[model samples]
Target chain A: MFLNLIRWFRGFVVFEIMGRFPERFINLSTRQGHFVLFSRPRKDNFTAALLLCDYRTIRPIARKSGVRLKVRERHGLPFLLGKYKARCGLLIGLLLFLIITVFMQSFVWTIEFSGLTTISQSTLKEALAEEGVFVGAFKPTLDLSAVQRKIMKNIDEVGWMSVNIIGTKAEVEVKEKELKPHILEANVPCNIKAGMDGLILSMNTKYGKAVVSSGSAVIKGSLLVSAVVENPSGDVSIVHADAKVMAQTQRTKSFVLERKGVFDKPTDEASRYRLRAFWLEFPITATSVKQSYTSRFETKSVFLNNTEMPISVTVEHCSRFSPNIYSLSQSEAQGIFAVEDYLYRLFSLSECESINAQRHYAETDSFYSMDVLYECEEDIAVYENLVVN
Target chain B: MNRKKIKSEQDKQNNSFGFNIKDAFSLKPRIEIFDNTSAVIDGSCGVLEYSETVIRVSLGELSLKLCGRGLTLKCISPTSLIVGGFIKSVEYIM
Candidate 1:
């Protein structure tokens, strides 16, 4: 039965291949609602040998030709050859279907984008074409994240960007960092007093009444301009005047400290070193590397608009700690260990810093914890716009 | 009689060695030949073989009786039809 089915299928294939020929096959002819053909191509003329006819009248012709013929009528073949021929209409339909399927699957139908920047849509689309991911690209092979990273790297103005493929389309969403201009409001009707006491350098007043001139000296918290004005009518009128009053005054800020320490032969004999391995242990470990510092580590972290958006990762970091006595000392034997340890830390921190060392010292074992104090200052020039009401 | 003689002569002239025996007669023939040669005169082309009582034509599916006959068709070869018949005249139409 299986063989018979295979034969039937093979016959179908044969019918399909032969059905493609034109209307002039030799032993082939169309009939009323049916067609039959003998397809015996001569070896040399393999393209030309097919004959068809109606069963109504070929009998006597064969008899006169003296050709012995056989008629194959299946007792249970179920489908007749004539019927099969009539159903050959499916061939054209199937061909059309295959052509349409191939056409539909050939082109890219959609595009999606993610992680885009201030880059415009058209610019991003053009950039995507450079990476072979344009409107018509085959979506499956496109590495969206890689394309996003490429775009972000190429356009550094982009603070954050992403490319995502949803279905057959690429969705590019960009997060652009825009620096907003700061608007400083000097709404208080106050005079620009001396920030620090110093000798009068030169006074420049763009607006408002300047009470002190270039040679005049002013003290801290002393008002240089007044918002009160006396007119010719002897009427006192208070106007909200805005001004820039610059005065140079003599200033002095000093810090004096007297140090005292009573250290008579600090005692240290033995030190114990503990080695703890986490070895995949999580949550908490055998030992935690917590620095015992007396001072807090000062870091300036900026949040997105100062509102706790996880964007507030650390920016500037200045740790507060004093070094370990042993680590501070350049002692011959301890120096090796310190050097090795520092080398390991330096290797681990290669992504974030360039280390610089200034000094080496040896201290007594007073059991003092690590402490760091920073006194860094910058000569900052600030604009003080005074407005008077 | 004249019609029969004229049909015989026409069969003699048109029927080639490989003509489908079923193409020329309505009386189903006992034998059939698949002619690679098409009908030189352009009617439904095939072959036929028949006796006085039956007709066989390579219409691919018909067993129509003409001039009184019952005919049965069987496969003798891939390109042949063996048609058996009962009674009456046979003729080649194409």
Candidate 2:
């Protein structure tokens, strides 16, 4: 194989010698320090031989040996190059393709993420990009340990992470931090008291004496469960009081709404689109409307397969609106039904278990005042530390 | 009697010096064949005969005849030659 390669590099030829004495031609060629690779006899004293020498050297040997030499075939790199020298563009294109293939092998092409639940993939990718580790980044310049440390430092929710780079793809594996419940101190001397004024619906005392029974009303800051216990021996000791006290509580809130106000109503809408390439943006449409309008922007980036490029198209929608003074009618303004609707929304927002509301209103010539009374079932137990003397 | 004594003395000197007389002065060819497919001749003079199935190489007083199918001289230098093909037999003719 190595000899064949050398033969190809230094050009070789296969020629046939036709003469009376072909054996003398071979002997003369070999004796003259010329390299003869293989020789085969043809029909009627013509001998074909593969010579590992330049084509120019075979003429003198064939003339001296009194034989006519005809080159049957020419093989090697020089001949191959000479045959394709006319098509210069094709050769240059082939060379460029090989160079580009080798150049592209040194950059990252894809990124894969796994074991992610809470931390977003975009957040991790953004952090990785800040540390110079992203798609299209050179692989040799990246320090995996430093990138891992930077990601961990940037995202506190990650407990442990690993960044693995394989060929043109980078795989990111992460574990999220576990959430732990808060633990309270036990065996402390404390009393459970009412945090708000409420009627006791149910009381479950675990380690204390219940001073207030079910269906009894208690005021705010009043003690419902006591930590002090007196035994038959006339000895008193303080203990931790643990209980769950469900009660019905009343909450009141009041707010006033203006009968006449100015509101903006959308009347006209227009949109403009632009393409963003790198740091420059090119407007695709010439629909720039500069007016008092509310604009909403939607950007869509181009992605080849799963890898994201830095090219995107943004569409901005502009809605032009005018403000007009809107006034309520006399009957609608004086009606208290709107306050009940707002009060129901407020009760739902507060996440009450069960609620009932009563509305009270006072109206003037221009505005109305509304007060809402909300009764809700809620847990009203507040812990108070007991002092021992 | 003098020539015999000198020959005996030369033989004794060669034995004591561990020298081979044939290796020192002989022009005999050394042929090595690998798996009956290729042959390397160390002391080739020139090509005596050329053909597809037979190749005869001259080495001073002796000639080597190689008979095979699809045989060719793979390489040839001033003093050595490599024959490659499906070699069937090799004969050294005096």
Candidate 3:
């Protein structure tokens, strides 16, 4: 039984009280009863004595005790011990596995890079690798400050980089540096003028003449938008007119659009699903196709460990074509208008008070083409100060 | 009876052993053993005339040399020496 206990401990079932066994005690099993007594004694002659006697033949040491002794008396091992030992093999296996898993998790398994533009991913990965923060390196060993310094030293384009350990994955958030724009500080004479039309609420004539007062009316190209002016008191001051003048005005714009559509392109291919470990490999054997394609294949690639591996699978899809021609449907034309509007806003073109748009011309030379005319008008300042004070 | 001869024998025993060659001259002195012998004077067999190199030996090896002083065997190697610093010169005992 003791040997079995030692074996269970060796298999890591019981770990806490392994080394606490008494050295001078021996437990023996006999036909009479189980004996647990000291194997060493204080006398110098005989080392110790360990014996067992039948319960009926030997007198009870505590005959006056109220408690009755039974052959299989409860030993009061903590109730949890038996429960723990019942499934010790599985519990111990799971516990050991959990410990090993935790050990592995404390180290880095993947290093994900985020917010990288202008600089290539491979270049950033290489820069990070030089700082000892690459894949498979221990996460605890990473000194983020040192890595930041090293990255800044190696790549001048990187303004700052933040490193964070999310469980077993290391995330490197990068921000490419912004370069200061060059400012022309020449001594050439220049001017500033009213940039927009609004009621001049406030004005300070710093180095230029105030052509229009707070309530004065100024036309779009009126002299109130001063090109050059003379101050009072006959000092002949050549003011730069480096002051803002605002007044209310109006604007108008127009656009002409002409469009056509031929046969709608046939289905190129049906969307398919392919399972891969790292999105690097795709084959048609496992991927199911539902339709056909009438267009050429376009290959898309994804990067893994600095290698650009193709992940796209192509299969030709086509449908029988009918000799048919068509015009732009209202929905398609509205979609185009939405896209045009979005592009116009994105390009920062001025808002139009009016639009004069028309279909200028259209042609069908292999593909449909359209010519659009857009016209616009707005109240803009014409007279700008061209002299410095 | 042979009292006079016994007396002479006793007298000889009272003095040091005849093998004690400490008072005798050594053809190769201690200075010669330690000196750079890449240069040797003319008429010296298998020896050089002039060189600046110095020979070195460890303390343990020197102790071995001191212990071999009483042995009547000489080493003839260029890089090794056997000093028979005791009575009489070495002879081929074999």
Candidate 4:
């Protein structure tokens, strides 16, 4: 196989020897250190292939052996180059295509991440971009080991990370650290204290000793249950204080709004598009935006034959707006206060047993203020650690 | 040659128990027949006669006649050659 390739590279000629004793020509050529391949014999003529260099020197042997040599076919690289020497542009284009394909393979085109549960992809990509592993990063210049070490060191959540640049795709695989429970256990020795100043409605003590009885008035930061239990013999035992103390609490909060409210109003809107291939971006639509405008961005990747390419299209929709002040009437001001009171109750008193609210409205020259007094019954037990040194 | 003489000659030439000059240096023709289908001959002298049903190969001291149908030389080099065909018989002619 290797000899055949060398023959094709140096060029070879298949010729026919037509004479009475062409077999003698074969014998003569073999004796003179010439390799004759694929020798096929006819009645008085035979065909065989010889290297182009040998063909030039074998004419004398063919004559001496009383045989006439006629060229049958030609092969190999020199003949091929000679046949298409006039069409230089085609060859140049073929070479240029190879050079470009090799050059383009050195840059990263696509980036993908796997094994992400708690950490967001955008946050990781931002961190990766800061570490020089983003899309369009030069593959030869990238130290993937260093990048992995740096990312694993900087990000506390990533337990294991691997970056592989295969062809044009940069695949990042990550394993996040399993999170531990943050809530404290009930077995720890602690005391239950009153969270707010209120009248104690009920007390349900599961462990330790209860210090406050039902219907007792207590202030905020007052201890409702003690972790130290003592018997009649005066022997003391420290245990975890577990109890639920329901209290009727009264609190007042003010919701204020100026008569003239300032809000951003949209004045105009504009849209533009950008095309990105690798790191180079080109604007497809004219860029238009106000000095202070909110924008929405949408990006879609380009695909060819169901495979995602490096190119993408980004559409930016900007809404131009300016701050405007409008004066509110009496009815509008009352409606706004009603909404504020409803939301405060819905969020703050959702877990209460019962709720009673009283609204007091007051208006000044510049603003409107509403004071809401709330009374609700809820569990007010809070844990306080006890140091027994 | 007769089968017994040919077998003895082959055993001596290819796998002799003692030292042999022609077998050691590969100076003479070596013929290997594969179940009568093809023959690989090392030290191929030359093609003496060619026909569709018969091929005469020179082996210096002896001439080998291969009788078959559709006989052709698969490949030929200076020292080695392979003959491929359906063989009815192989004759060692004097």
Top model by TM-score, which number?
2
Q: List the residue pairs that clash in candidate 4.
A: none
> Which candidate do you rate higher for lDDT, 1 or 3?
3
The top-ranked prediction according to lDDT is 4
- Could you tell which candidate, 1 or 2, scores higher by lDDT? 2
DockQ of each: 0.04, 0.44, 0.00, 0.31
- In order, the TM-score of chain B in each prediction is 0.28, 0.72, 0.16, 0.72
- The reply for model 4, stretches above 4 Å from the true place, is A1-20, A42-120, A138-193, A196-202, A206-223, A226-242, A246-270, A284-294, A302-311, A322-378, A382-389, B1-71, B78-94
Give i-RMS (Å) per prediction. Answer: 11.9, 2.2, 39.2, 2.4
Ranking by lDDT: 4, 2, 3, 1
Tens-place lDDT per residue, model 1, A1-389, is: 79446545434212211222222222233322223332332222212111222333444433443443344332222245455677777867888899976754543444454554456777777787887776456656777678778877887667777766654345567787686776534344444555544444455555456676666555666666565667789987654444544433221222221122333332222222222111111222232233432222222233344322111122222233433333233244354445644564456334322233323333345321212121211111223444434
Q: What TM-score would each prediction reach against the true structure?
A: 0.28, 0.62, 0.38, 0.61
Tell me how many residue pairs clash in candidate 1.
Answer: 104
Instruction: Locate the minimum summed-lDDT window of 10 residues in model 2 chain A.
Output: A46-55
| Candidate scoring better on DockQ of 1 and 4 | 4
State the lDDT of candidate 2 residue by residue for A1-389, as single tens digits. Answer: 99789888876787877887676777677677675665666556554545345457767877877888888888888788888999888899999999998987788776789999988899898998899887678889999999898778878998889999887778899998897776554678999999999999999998778999999999999999999888789998788888989899998867465677889887689989999754468999998687677899999988888665547799999998888888776567546457555755665536557788787876666666677788888878899988767
Which runs of model 1 end up more than 4 angstroms from their true locations? Answer: A1-189, A199-202, A247-389, B1-42, B47-94
Off by over 4 Å in 2: A1-12, A28-34, A45-53, A74-77, A101-117, A120-180, A185-202, A213-223, A227-240, A246-380, A384-389, B1-25, B30-42, B52-56, B62-75, B80-94
Worst 10-residue lDDT window, candidate 4 chain A: A37-46
Sorting all predicted structures by DockQ, with the top scorer first, yields: 2, 4, 1, 3
